[model samples]
Target: MKRIPLLLASLLLLAACTAPAPSTASTPAETPAAPVETPADPANAGDVHMLTNRYDGGQYTTCLVPSGSYCVSKIDYAAATAHSMCQIPGCQHTTSDCPVLSAGHLLVDGDTLWYPYIVHSDSEYAYALAAYTDDITPPAHPLFAVTHYQTDLVYSVNVLAADEEYLYFVGNSSYAFGGAGPNGAEAYLFSAEKSTGLQAQRLRLDTLLPGQNAYWTLSAAEGRSLYLQYSLFSDNTSGVYRYDLDTRQCSPLPQLTQNADTLGTPLCSPQVVYDLQQGSITAVDVPTGQSTLLTDTFPTGDSYTYAAASFRDGWVLSYSLWKEQDAFTHQFFRAPDGTLTELPQQMYCDARGTTPVNILDIQNGLVFLQYAYDTVPVSSYDYEGNPYTYDTYLPVYGIIPLQDLLAGSQNYRKLTFD
Candidate 1:
């Protein structure tokens, strides 16, 4: 199924008006899918600040900045504030030139950019998960693309996420959809290394869910184990499970918000869990599994239950107050010291209505928003004159230093791309 109705997006954002909080970690918080998603409010449709002429845009994300990082987040702005990333004398980072069409996932580790590339052979398109480093010549690479792994189901597969240790991709039929059993549905895990293109054993996990099957989303990896979550609750569990890359075993983590843990805004680490079931955020001792409640009154408001969001560097917890579909309306981060820092709140308008600002990556003092893009198609050609076409292109996406954004300086923290 061409999942994301818009340009084949994957993993639609999930939020609940209010999911019942379990009394403790063992309780399930399978959020009832928000009422049939309504078209974004017409009022939100009127905002042109983000899609205006002066700004550039790229697919925003909440995942880690390079790869194998955090999930995504969003915010709302009242007006289109002027902000640009740190630019050098001749640095080029705008998404204006659509070099190669992506088969829908990208990962940046250290200096190499890894992506599943789409190739047009005759009339059919094939895909390869490939990598390119800054060491290579620009505008043109050595091969049609560097291949790490080749697969026939490019269109059928979407990357759930990536991190330092592994490159992850999920396809409906690649293996995750191979079959089913009484224990649960079977999903596949295909991992690759970042430094060298090495393939790991393909793991099939029967994450028991109520429905047909369950797929794993890489939440975090540490020491010798990797953490995974289900697109839907897996193996009748809500929190992240520890998956040993070597043993392929799965175990539950009770301290993390297993009741409300989600891929959209997952903990992504073993250190913290946003368990609303206990109505508080807690810090976990990974080795001991002991948790200390960090904050009982996580930022909330009158019409919001203050859904617990993701954690940043295991030191801050992100929360968005949701009235209905307003996942990014108001946000605040809680630190280990029990201090709260609220970022600037702004709202944007589209032809539909006012909507929240799209926040991509949040960590270590930086916040990347899928903001600002030129009014052009994200299409371009490579050195070989191979052409590509994206439904929409991003001319600029804004990156704001968390401190400046909080201080109300509208300048992008500054960056340059080759």
Candidate 2:
């Protein structure tokens, strides 16, 4: 899933039109002959994001390969291989006839895989959320359409976290086909019940945070709460806020402070808030507001600068260091045991040169990375006859055993879906 940052204008008007009525389409049957048991405890779920990849017991993700169409895929950890979710015999996976082809961002909750998609009919579009059983069944059918709408605004919803009762999501609205609306683009938090097929209720940002001109991002999700990081554009102040899923309450965490920096955004896990400052990493406990020094061992000289840091099961710290004359990003993995190991700079290389690898997620004792290789370059000219050239990069997903990665080994397997 991709998040396009848009300035919030006319919050009241935006919020009023955010919720659309549920569609009349009948819900699909959810019961299978043999049902898989999902954990009742919310703690089993990790933080979800608007990313292309998500991992529960196995890897459920989407990737754009050499083919122009995006394919929904699953990575088998035991076999270290990937295949498309579509199982229709002799069906081309690129078209809409394939049941699971191009399914949007995926979230695996025990036995079910949930995703959001758009349904276009004649002149109207409906943003619909659906789910299917996670099994090797031919012609997968959705268990149900949880929420559906035919509204004037174009809806793009990203499913973030789900529990036993409700699914939490963050969505934004825009005019259809880039047409301008009376109000500008807007984003909001919403929650929908699993049992009820009703339109989701938009969580009031004004009543929840009581602020104006603030930009919000759903940073992380813990057991029953979501951690939102917000920046006040009015005064240039930023902080982390917590929203409870059950009580529908929002409160700011005084212990956490978001400071502007050249380094990337700070990561907030359920227990720890990992912040990078001046070539050092600090871990702050969320409950007690206590701070612990994780490491300051990275190069802090004039030549090296901190780039970014990400946390899943552990920490992946990225920084830039001058090599000969060009600056290159160097990444390191800090294990839960306080051991730090340098990671490989590139996942693989072709004629386009070495492609840098990014840590997507760490789950089920595996590390998921996303890399890309450039395709053919396209050249075009403007009306003024000025020449312009651009290259399109196709994304590739790879997986590595977490232990091997921590041991400083680059033995990774590329996932392929034929």
Candidate 3:
């Protein structure tokens, strides 16, 4: 824990008091870890900073933490009038009070914000993006915006991840999905820059692993180290592998995905893979290839619903439900003992409607949802060749109060990628 200076503490005391309480939650047997204390008016703690739904948007995948502000901007839109972005010392925006919207799955590198976007040109859709490194008092926002670059791409692009120096992404030129290789992507990994054209890298693993399938789903990034799901060809071998950007070395994680099927982002930590079903979790000690099973902490198998689990901080959150025909969803929080705490009411809106909320992950005391906003219209023509438009509806981020949800409160807050 960093020490709070006396003078700074004096200035921050009242301000911190006025700030929302630190989000915290504990189960019946274990004491929760203390909430992360945030500093007030933090400046320049620049740190380095995704999913398409069946297409690999990479949501819940992040490594950037705003160091400039003691508390980065997080919001709870439901209590908009009363909610405030976490800005006080000792404050951690892990609750419904902080909503973070990630526009087109944005990234934060130091003071700069980075993301991938599209612009229409002479005859095709050109891939481009912007970055905001300016940290001013009023935050007007532009060090740069929507600067175009030649990616030489013919299909849709997926913005993967960003580090302190480069924005990494993939260019897919394939149309239609098949059960095998190529999958439409022309390049597996391309490192883009603000000043130069996209530089295509063969993942440096192309020859070493020689995977024909070229399975590339970025699971998580920690520091300059990135964890990916790579199925190197040969015996159909597939596992989560860690690639160190600093060293250009790639190693396989056997325990991480040895028998894994449904996968979820590791959220804050990259050492573990949260199994979506079968009530089990696999964790890999990055240095050693040793793996461990944590199925004991999962819900005792239930016939009423099918469930998947996600681990964040100290809590393993899971949700269960029947098929679309069943028409309802249930959420649960598993304590260290696997005891399940079910949310009071059913979640989701019929599993097939204009649902503005999707569960991203769960903390000890809060549930994070991908909250949609800033409606960008997708241009098109209707049956008679008329302009038919609907919002692109990409979710940035949002937080739902656990108490409120468990208590049946319909209100929550949102955070935008500004």
Candidate 4:
């Protein structure tokens, strides 16, 4: 029996948020332009960002609270508070009995909150889809289920994106008895229609791009089209492709394709697809393929790599990875008018500047962050008697008002079960 290596799983997870861009372009040292006002289309913004999704006027996310269990929580931007979606009284929130806890990896679409859950039987395992709503109680049974024969296999099924008609997901199944060929695992893209009952249709990526072993991540969805980022394992090449749901056709975006190898995974808004390339943030118009330089003045040196970006409320948030320092460094917020404002480094680090913080998502005038807390140092030695010391920190989720973040305030409020 063989399983998907943890490193590969981790790389897939990282691809969901960021992509590494290695280039020969020289580093630039110039201050970013001052803040100005630019308008963005609210209708064009997609439903996905980091681990949270926006629907109607609310923001929803699944997070691990202090209770040692994952719980789905809703953020109230007006009140600047986050509380578990579960309303059951006296719930410890540490068991599947909690409705919100059970429905993991939530995707808020329209009036429904959809999630994927697994069912175990004596002979087979069922990967299923379930929905939750504010106006009604949680359903006891899943609306759809896909059965697998290998009961002991290791697998992951996640709901990636949803439109009015169908929900799209990626499923990876690791065979326990060598059924998945040499890789020992298989990846698939599936779609389940909202109106269809108990059905999951596997999509053919091979039909779009032939003879390539690749995995996909849904970067953005608009109307009848889906923007997918794919990495081909055969040649170690990566790029973005537009897949039309209506025509079942796929085409490469030439503007993005030109620098595909250097252009990392994109942060897509309705009107633009932004990528980090050659130490600068570049935006490509979705409709016209017109390229625009967002900012090139982000502090780029030999030690830093422009890591990732997220767009929300007309603001583009980006960060750089510090190679030598082993931390996420040089965080910035690019206003609509192209004004680049640097978030103080202290906000992401402790007094001694050891802990690393990740900017998870920005939405609804709020900034979601994940960092380690209550850390303790752990030291050990290798087989060659080499000394090594590392800190063990518990990861925690928190939020900061977007206005406060722009104004250089570190008023972080932890999303706790209490």
Candidate 5:
């Protein structure tokens, strides 16, 4: 596993799409995944603006300069949008929640950024969204892109695929909602397009164990099929599956391992209750149902806490954390030939009371986050005097690739929503 450095790349302009400029904060800086080229459509032009709010305050938020600027918001939601911070010359103080996207999801569809605003309500699990925009404008209201499928379902989804063609997500259909029991839960796929909007399409399962389920990961392989790891929904068996959109079919790959969760958490938990080591990377052939175990030689001690893993370009990079006593660390690794290459630097602090960090999007060697800096349990300081704290959505960072991090690898799987 090769390490991926968590360093911010210098901002550069490419065509109309530019990298997210650096912010003023010393802690986790705000960085956009990649500059999205806005379509000439007027409806989407306003969608390119970047904005964020302070959870400590009301619904008030600050916007970044449309051209290219950085801003920081206070806990009270008092945001200061400047070309740069007062301290850093040629730098701006802008505010954005674009960097702190929740774990395992990215919203960039082509150039248009689909911001996911997770909705919490009685009968709806809607994600309020804003379209793509260029700068910070007042009344920074996001467009309400609601999901038509409403349920009290217990499904966990991470953004699996996003491109100009469609938006693909993997989640479980709950047995609780119009279900028989726990086994009633099944994996599903949802899609959306710039013209067609959002659509729900249930994937055909080769085996329905009712209790068997799998979460969508960022794992990419060749062909037009998306790879996944599935386990018995209950406390016993485990399996993996691959769904082919071209054929609208699915098949079981293999069972890497299973150590049932005692606490009954989602498929993304970092702990193990049954088998000390369960759930390694498994590749499946969508058409033939063949599969291979990528990493069987598990490491000792603890595995870094990463929300997910993906084979982008030619490398397998997993977002992980390694716990050393009281410190919680986060990093990315290049898993080539079963060997895990740890990134050169730690992406972010995985300490107690630290803000929730998520890798929202990765494109052209840059990572985007829907970051939120909240109250953590740890007390530490960065090089700057400011405590290592996430008061709120401060700024977004547009990272650049330090090295060919995805070197020595294979291609990722592909599928079409049309």
Candidate 6:
């Protein structure tokens, strides 16, 4: 563990003692591993940041821990009076205390906080958004007061995309008497202006693709159009449907070919396709829908299952063509121009890489990555007097400029902005 000064440790303990004790459920059993300690007041840490979410006592609390020895509290309206102090060194003295927030996803636009919330009294979901411009401070006067707006379409709504003009979400409801009957789901597209509260319209996915499976990933395409990636059967030949905004129609893009019949966006657009059946890639034109074949990067006859296609200055695709399931030496490809380019040390293992892999979200030339790790148990305990095993699952969230990824660094500094 990272060494902490005796005085700092005492202060942290005192602060923690004064705060409410947050309880957690027992975790799974696992062998213990040494805790990785980071330096305190770490300034040179890269854009990699860490966020910890602990669901304890029926409430969810998230902490934003920046590089070594820095932790800040996140506050929301629900946690108006909840006081959060840094458990790490240096943070308590320098950074502003975060306010406790209600349970939901926290959206940040340069300190302007927006959370999708449901008005329990009316049981309708609304966007609880707060924007702070210029001089006004936060946790005091959330520029816009809490206003209740309703979209009389569905009950449980999960917002998929939101902008100044429109908000898109998926609403699921069961058919008929709310029994164990078949469920009906719709993709709700809502538009809002300053004068009108919210205008909503629903599009049924089943009606669009009659027999297609549940519509899962809903992403905004160019204006008024949505791209949906959904699974069909247990095997190949799924579909990526484009929902037109003007005509209110869903159609599978004309050029996407099926292999083994499984289909997914290996990378978002203007890129090559990973043919599952042929085990190769084919480039496609978004405008014309014309497709051209490309050479296979992996050894011929090697069935390399594609993982993800990340957008960078170029396309950064993740492919796991393992020689065998659960094998140590797996291959990775970083094809920039739909052409094959090899990377050293392709294989990744749990002891080295991490479980559940990682995702690359490249935004504004900044590359943000989220990864998960399994930590062994230091101790076990009983839950409400019932015996249970315990272990820790740590999730690491960080960001780096796209340049860093292109440069390929062996070392990175941690980022902490409480």
All candidates: CA RMSD in angstroms? Answer: 14.5, 10.2, 16.7, 11.6, 16.9, 17.4
lDDT (CA) per prediction: 0.39, 0.51, 0.38, 0.51, 0.33, 0.34
lDDT string for model 1 (1-418, tens) is: 0111112244322220011123211222122212222111122222111010111223222222221112221111212222122122332322322332122333334344443444444444444444533332112322222221343222222333444445544332333344334444434455445445344434443334333443454544455555555433323334445555444455665544343432224423344455444446665544345757667765534443433444352233455565666555445555556667665645343332333345554555566564443334457887899998754423344577667766755576433321
Q: Which tens-of-lDDT digit does each residue in 1-418 have in candidate 3?
A: 1111011111111100000011210111111112212111111222223222111212223312332122223232333211222233443434322222122233434344443334444544444444423322112232222212433332223334554335555332221122223322222444544344334342522322111222344545556665554332222334555665554566655455432223233221334444444556555544354655544355333433333444442344444444446534445555546455655443332223433245555555566665443344578999999998775433345567666765666566654332
Full-model lDDT, candidate 4:
0.51
Please provide TM-scores, in order, for all candidate models, with all chains considered together.
0.51, 0.65, 0.50, 0.67, 0.42, 0.52
Q: Between the candidate structures 2 and 5, which one is better when assessed by lDDT?
A: 2
Q: Is candidate 3 or candidate 6 better by lDDT?
A: 3
lDDT of 4 by residue, 1-418 (tens): 1111111123243322121122311111122211212112223333422223655334666666656556667765445456677778877677656766634445666667665556655654666666765532245656666656643223334535665555666544433122333443334445555665423433433311223244456656666666655444444444555665554556666445433344444334322333343456666544346666767765555555554454565444455565654765556777777777877735323434643356667767777776445565779998999999987555566777778877877678875554
Compared to the true structure, candidate 3 yields what TM-score?
0.50
Error (Å) of candidate 4 at residue 171 is 4.8
lDDT for predicted candidate 3 compared with the true structure: 0.38
Determine which window of 10 residues in candidate 1 has minimal summed lDDT. Answer: 46-55
Give the candidate order by descending lDDT.
4, 2, 1, 3, 6, 5
Least accurate stretch of 10 residues (summed lDDT) in model 6? Answer: 11-20
lDDT by residue for model 2 (1-418), tens = 1211111122111110111111311111112211223213334334433332345545665556445566566766556566776566776666666555666445566555665555445543455556544443221232223222433333334434566665665544433123324453334565555665333544533211222233444556656677655444333444566776545566667556544332134333332322333457665544345665556776676676664354567777666766677767777777778777877647454554554577777766787777455465778998899999976656666778888876766776876566
The residue ranges of model 5 lying beyond 4 angstroms of the native Cα positions read 1-106, 121-123, 128-130, 135-149, 154-158, 162-164, 174-183, 202-222, 235-237, 255-418
Candidate 6 lDDT tens digits, 1-418: 1111111111111100000011211111122221212112212222211111212111112333332222223432222222233233333322323222213333342223333333333443333323322322122333222222432233222233443434444432222112222223222333222123233433444421222222233433444455543332223333345655445566665344343233334213333556665666565544345665544554334445654354433444445545755532232334455554332222134556533324334445554444334354545556567656665444454444555545553232332343
Pairs that collide, model 4: none
Per-residue lDDT of 248-295 in model 5, one digit per residue for the tens?
A: 455544333444332122232121222125534444333344544544
User: Candidate 6, 231: how far from true, in Å?
Assistant: 4.9
Compute the lDDT of residue 176 as modeled in candidate 6.
11
- Order of candidate numbers by TM-score, starting with the best: 4, 2, 6, 1, 3, 5
Error of 2 at 77 (Å): 2.2
